[model samples]
Target: MILTVHHVTTYEYDAPMRGAVQSLRLFPSRFDGQRTIRWDVAVEGGLRGGNFRDGAGDKVEGWSLRGPVSEVTISAIGQVETTDTAGVLRGHREIVSPFAYLRETSATWIDHALRDLAETAVTGVKEPLDRAHRLSRAVSDAIAYRPGTTHAHTTAAEALAQGEGVCQDHAQALIACARAVGMPARYVSGYLFAREDGAPHEAAHAWAEIWVENIGWIGFDPANECCPDARYIRIGSGLDAHEAAPIKGIAQGDGSERLDVTVALEAVQQ
Candidate 1:
């Protein structure tokens, strides 16, 4: 399948900021599952800086904007060809060991409830792949998809306690549970084409990837209760959503900031 994406993020500050710097992980991942045809990222009134591939094999780019700047806009446009690999990440070069993902973040911190959930989900399940599938299912069963029920700062434990959240919550909760079972897991941010199942999901999506002893990192979307397929476009990953964020930036001022984002993804006929 061929997919086209248009994503724009704008930040508005009530009071002008002195300046801003941003790190972007908006480029799609390179793997057997997907190939980027053409991609471009631009920031209005900003200069592109150092670019490099991180240890996780993610392409990172830096940008800077001079102020008194009240608003900043970042745009990413691209097309990618994807094939279904049954969620298995393959042919991706990375130096980071899977064990490194075992480190938990605040967003994916495990608690007694998460531990119990993990134990119950994987009990009697021996295969690491099966254990991962079970954990994904458990998270899907535990959290009802409700968009506004949680916020950016909502943690996995809190989302599980509330039993309602979006894809981010589901991913974090699954990560927490997977780690509880001694499996290496990380959060994945990406884009998803329209679902034939009519499930509610944004074009931008988040999921979890668990490392099996022999299978490597495999993606599991608890929010959709399935493995990623051709419909999904892989992006950068991290221990949690905050770390996997497509865009991270800081403005050198005390201005109150508000953000707005819009994303459109569609399948293009080959």
Candidate 2:
């Protein structure tokens, strides 16, 4: 299946920013079961300073906001061809070491709640693959999918405690829980195809992947509670969403900044 993606992020500052630098991770890389045919990124009200790959191997672009800048816009467009591999991404070169994924982050720290959640989610789950599937479903069901209830800084325990959050929250909870159970889990930021109209949505999607003994790494969308298929386009992977964030930056002249993000993931018929 062929997928087309459009992601636009605009920052409106209450106060004009001068001499600001920003980092962007909006580009997707080619991997097994997924191939990027064409991809480009454009900026408005800013100049592209440079581009490089991050520690996690994500393509990143740097931009410098000109003085007296009140708003900055970033747009990324790409097309990718994806194939279903029975939920297995075979022969894809590992971007991060398995040991690194097991490392805990602030948001995904192992705790009692996480361990218990993992135990319950993987209950009666014998095979590692089966456990992953169950864990995904359990997280989706356990946490009510509600927007505006959580933010990017919300941790996995907090979301689990609240019983409500968006895709990011669900992914974090799942990752923390999986790690608590001694499974190496990582975060995945990407796009998901909507079910109602088969149209793309404005917000980006997130999921979790766990490294198993024999199967290598497997992805699970706790928000969607399903394995990645043709509908998913993976942009990057890391210990948590913060590491794989599509865009992150700091401004020199700081006061407050308003962010407007719009993402569209469409499935094109051949």
Candidate 3:
């Protein structure tokens, strides 16, 4: 399947700022499951800076804008060809050890409830792959998908206790549960094509990936209750949502900032 994406993010400050700096992980990943066709990223009135692939194999680019400017916009447009690998991340190159993901982040911190859930889900399940699938299923069963029920800063424990959240919370909760079972897991940010069932879903999405002993990293979308397939376009990953965010930046000024984002994904005609 071929997917085309258009994503735009805008920042508006009440007062003109002196400058702004941004780090972007907006490019698609390189792997057997997905190949980049054509991609471009641009920032209006911004200067592009150092760009490189991080240890985790995601492309990172820097940008800066000098101002007195009150508004800035970043846009990314791309096409990618993807194949279903049953959520297995094959042929992606990265030097970071999977164990590095075992380190907990504030967003994915495990509590007694998470530990118990992990243990109960994996109990009597021996195969690492099976354990991972069980964990994903457990999280899916635990959290009801509901938008606006939680905030960006909500932690895994809080989400689990609340029993309702969006994709980000589901991904983080799954990450915390996976780590509780001694598995290395990380959060993934990307785009998901509209479901065949026509269910409502955000074009921009988040998921979790767990390291199976022999399987490397495999993606699991508890929000969708399935493994990633051709409909999924890989972008970037990190220990939590903040790290995996496609855009991270700081604007110079005391002026308050308002952000608006829009993303659209569609299947390309063959």
Candidate 4:
């Protein structure tokens, strides 16, 4: 299957920003089940400073605002060819180390709640792959998918207690849980091909990947209750959302600023 994606983000400041620097992780990843055929990122009211790969192996571009700009626009367009591996990304070259994934981050703390959740999710389950699937399903059943209730900073425990959250929360919760169980888990940010629609959506999707002894790293999307298929496009991988965030930056002068983001996709079947 082939998937095309278009993602646009705009930042409007209440007051003009001077000497602003921004980092972007909007580029799709090239991996075993996924191939980036063509892709380009464009910026308006901003100039590209440099491009580099981040710790998470995400292709990132650094940009500087042009002339104390009041607004900045970033757009990315791309096409990728993907194959279904039944959640098994076999024979793929490993870009990340499993041991490295165990390191804790601020957002993915292994707290009591996480430990308890992990115990419940994996209990009475045998087989590493099957345990992962069961945990994913348990998360889906435990948390209701709802919007406008949680933010990017919401913690795994908070979302679990609330009983509802978006994909980010789901992924984070799963990560926390998996980590608590001594599984090397990391956060994944990417595009999920919507069944009713297609690639791009209101926002990029989030998923969790756990490392198994033989299989290495395998993706599990608790929100979707399945492993990633051809419809899933890999982007970045990190300890948590903060590290894998699509856009993050700081301005020299900061009073208050408003951010507006829009992401859309048009599917081109092949």
The TM-scores, one per candidate, come to 0.98, 0.91, 0.98, 0.91
Candidate 1 ranges beyond 4 A from true positions = none
How displaced is residue 251 in candidate 3, in Å? 0.7
lDDT of 2 at 64: 82
> What TM-score would you give candidate 1 relative to the actual structure?
0.98
**Off by more than 4 A, model 2:** 123-126, 196-203
Across 15-108, the per-residue lDDT of candidate 2 in tens digits comes to: 8877577788877645687888898888786788888776556787898876777888889998988887655666565456776787889988
- Model 3 poorest 10 in a row by lDDT: 194-203
Q: Write the per-residue lDDT of candidate 4 for residues 103-123, one digit (tens) a residue.
A: 887777777867787898888
In model 2, the worst 10-residue window by lDDT is: 194-203
Ranking by TM-score: 3, 1, 4, 2
In model 4, residue pairs whose N, Cα or C atoms come closer than 3 Å (at least 3 residues apart or on different chains), thus clashing, are none
Q: Clash number for every model?
A: 0, 1, 0, 0
Model 4 CA RMSD to the hidden true structure, in angstroms: 2.4
CA lDDT for candidate 3: 0.95
Tens digit of per-residue lDDT, candidate 1, span 1-270: 999999999999999999999999999999999999999999999999999999999999999999999999999999999999999999999999999999988999999999999999999999999999999999999999898999999999999999999999999999999999999999999998865396646999999999998989999999888999999999899999999999999999998999999999888954
- lDDT, candidate 3, 159-254, per-residue tens: 999999999999999999999989999999999997536797899999999999987999999999999999999999999999999999998889
Clashing pairs in 2: 202-263
Candidate 1 CA-lDDT value:
0.94
